[model samples]
Target: MTMRICALLATMMLLVGCATDDPDITVKHRVPHGSTVAVVMFQDCGIPNQADCAGSGAAAGSIFIRILSQKPGLHVASLPRPVAASAPLTDDAAVAYANKKGYRYVINGEVQDYYRTGHLALHSDRVAMSVRVLSVKDGQVLVTYTYQEDSKTHFASPDDMLEDMAKQLATSIVVEPKKQRQGDFMFYKGNGG
Candidate 1:
């Protein structure tokens, strides 16, 4: 009985350790304050012959736009519906579109993989995507982020995973100072003039 109890405790400890591991991986680059950004629909790059990949990319793109719309500090520009689920806008095209639309930057990417398993109970869900941030002025690539999540033990639906991924992506780019700026002068009582 004691040995069984000890084994159970060890198993529980291992599970707890695994649960606490961070799943988010993000790489960030500098984006100027108050810059306007437009999010282009992501293209689907799922496995060939897979029917489910049909609209996954567009869905991911829409999710990111919705999440970013609520984020403060940066201006979000309206973008037309994706031309094709598997066709992403080229860098030059994205830059020209942003310029024409009065935006400083553009965000676009592809949904490389997405899948859900176990229909009745929803055993697991996985999503992978690649994101790019480009400048409209020079058509320069500023940052690229690759994100993937596989949730088996956490019990999250595919939609939930996508929403969380979008939120994470939006959080990385929407940086703002905590205090509101009042023109060039920023007065602080403690700092000596």
Candidate 2:
């Protein structure tokens, strides 16, 4: 019996090794380098007046921001939690807050949806996130990116799924920089170092 079990395990390992890797898999998007980013917790975008899943959504956004800060080549700034609150929560108050923090780019976000539904005979959890970026200098929107994911897990643990979502968000923000032409005077200082 032990011999038979070993044979079965070996076969399974071989089959797994034979599986093809995905060629189209990519995470990072194209973004300029050295841009100062201000990450804020996404506000609740769900129906108002009722206590929905706002806290969880906000928590997820916070985690996503933390993960994004750890990525390479991104100049992320730290703003206070209250200062990073929702648009309606802070209103025009965010301008002063950003100026005080010396951040050029402000990221405002909203968690539109998050839910876990059971399939006919199986169970799964779905997580969705949406975020908007605004240029505080001119009040122009930079971009808005939304991410969603669904996965199945055993009853004992769902941490893996959450980690996967965080990873996806982190990958999405890792982007390449754009090039710009500079005038001679821009670099021609008296003391060129």
Candidate 3:
């Protein structure tokens, strides 16, 4: 009996030791403070019906921007609306617009497999969301993040569905801050002139 109890305690300690409070598991580009960012509404690459998620995508980007914006010197621009013209904001266009808006960096993504439910045949229902980001200037792929949540809801409303998706959207996108420019800062400083 004492041996069994000791084994159980050891197992519990091992589990506790493995636990972590670190929120961000993925590391992507990290932008520093005073850096401006413009986010384009993420496109839904999964299903046609889920394609036009500008409203929800914008909301999701807002959540992501909110967290990144919290960095002491960062300033984020409102996400750009999807343009119906020509090619839906070409990479060059996105960069130009962001620069025009005085943003030093920008965030744009593609979202897919996004869905929500109030109830499942089982006791718990699940929400799923996925997205990928691309860096326009260097054509560097940033990160792809996916999230799902399961919970019990007595009744699901449109708001409830949206809220769950937004929650997952916010938590899963754990982008690291871009590295600060290392060598001598060679750029001219704006003096409100």
Candidate 4:
């Protein structure tokens, strides 16, 4: 019985070691609280030969807008919908639009790849996307985030992955409050200053 338990534990450890690492999600900049943001249309950069596998850029942008709106300290603006095959707005144009709309930041994204593989009960969905945050004041890109995920599940869909990506992006942008100084002295009106 002891040998059997040790063997099982060793197998479990081997299996755990074989598991792949989670996808890397990076946030290059910090967005302060109470900032107004506009989410522009995402550009599709999927392979030309795999047009059918490509997802809608507009849909991705919409997902980001929806998720970012729910994040505390962010005010999302109502922006125009993106059309398929239409090129993303130039930086100048985007900055101009954001200025006109009173938004401090503009978000743009690109769907680098979107596809699924396998059939029946065996399938995996993959999504690769990049998001950028630009400042309206100077048209400078403040931060860029990129994520790629391949989820193997029987019932998972592309939309689900996209929503998850949006949630991840939203969570990455939230800025935590600065820690207070531990050595600072406290004063009260009734006590000596």
Candidate 5:
């Protein structure tokens, strides 16, 4: 079982690295610190030969909320799961719906790929996803990025990587802290809109 221990240790190390600076995470815009947000759940990509994750949309959204809620400055909640397997919402539609429902921001995404092969101490895992954060009031995209992590022929599972990805996502989405008032208007740095 020493091999198993080694594998687990390796996976733990990867997770530690994940929580640090992930170059894949790009923050284009930052919302207000106390914005209220909702998730529209993710839709799985029906890639040829990819693993079947029929409920992965809801799965990813749930995991995101589980982590993002722990972060300060953002109030997070999941919208009602859409009819168990409904068609995915477009970014515009999600933002409009959320705005009408009074949410300040909305999170929408799609899980492009997810697969894990092998088991025991020799598992290989990969998960690819794209996330979008939009201002519900005006449909301005605040933050967006796609992340792919593959423990190719390694010991980590996709679940561990996805959790770490969510943590990084939480970091990338905090509100823009720097604001300046010039002339008769105000603007925040890194404003995607």
Candidate 6:
């Protein structure tokens, strides 16, 4: 009985370790409460060529606004493209623009890969993206998120893939407040949480 329990505990520990997320992609500083975040248009990689890169970039930008807006207490907005041709298209530029506009944080991403490989149920919709969360005040990057799904994991459309990515991106930006400890019990800090 003792040996069985010990083996079970060992297995559980191993599983817990495996379940941990990649530390390199974790959020550094949490975005402050009651602050506005702007999401800029994602840049498309145009892999193999420039086929659907433009479309995918627009789709990604819209998806970020839609999904993140649904999160409670998160203020999400779609940052418009620069009107002046002199303004460069880059993450640093986006951050600067967001800072000037008085936003608290900014999100910028790149749609690296968007294509299907194979056919029907056996097909793999290869999708890769990288998102960065920047501090509008100091231009510091708080989070750098990257995801790639190329395995035979979906029979869904590329739009579905973008939605999934947006959901993950939300997790990286908007973190839930930690539970307050009251002796052996834990509770929310307040109604705001």
Per-residue lDDT tens digits for candidate 3, residues 97-164, read 66566665666654433444435444433334444444546644454445544343424433344464
lDDT of 5: 0.74
Best candidate according to lDDT:
5
| Local accuracy of candidate 5 as per-residue lDDT tens digits, 1-193 | 6999999998987776455334365667876787778987777655766655666666777888888888788789888645444366689888877877788899988887777675554545677888899887788888887887777446557677778778888888886444522345666778676
Better of 3 and 5 by TM-score: 5
* Clash-forming residue pairs, model 3: 30-176, 30-177, 30-178, 31-178, 33-73, 34-73
Query: lDDT tens digits, residues 1-193, model 6?
Result: 6999999998886665334233237688867655678988777655666465556766777987899887766889888766332223677788888878888799877777777544466555666778889987778889888876654434446667678777777766765655422345667788785
The count of backbone overlaps in candidate 3 is 6
Model 1: per-residue lDDT, tens digit, 19-78?
Answer: 533434454564666777898878886588867688887788778777777777666765
How many pairs collide in each candidate, listed in order? Answer: 0, 1, 6, 0, 1, 0
Better of 4 and 5 by TM-score: 5
TM-scores, all candidates, are 0.73, 0.54, 0.48, 0.70, 0.73, 0.71
Candidate 1 residue runs with Cα over 4 Å from true position: 1-28, 118-123, 178-193
lDDT of each: 0.72, 0.54, 0.50, 0.70, 0.74, 0.71
**In model 1, what is the error at residue 10, expressed in angstroms?**
12
**Model 5 misplaced regions, further than 4 Å:** 1-23, 49-51, 81-86, 121-123, 176-193
Off by over 4 Å in 2: 1-31, 44-54, 81-96, 116-123, 152-193
lDDT score at residue 43, model 2, on the 0-100 scale? 65
TM-score, prediction 5 = 0.73
Candidate 6: list runs displaced more than 4 Å: 1-24, 83-88, 116-123, 151-154, 175-193
Candidate 3's C-alpha runs over 4 A off are 1-29, 49-54, 84-90, 119-193
Which pairs, if any, clash in model 1? Answer: none
lDDT for 8 in candidate 2 is 100
What TM-score does model 3 achieve against the real structure?
0.48
Model 6 local distance difference test score: 0.71
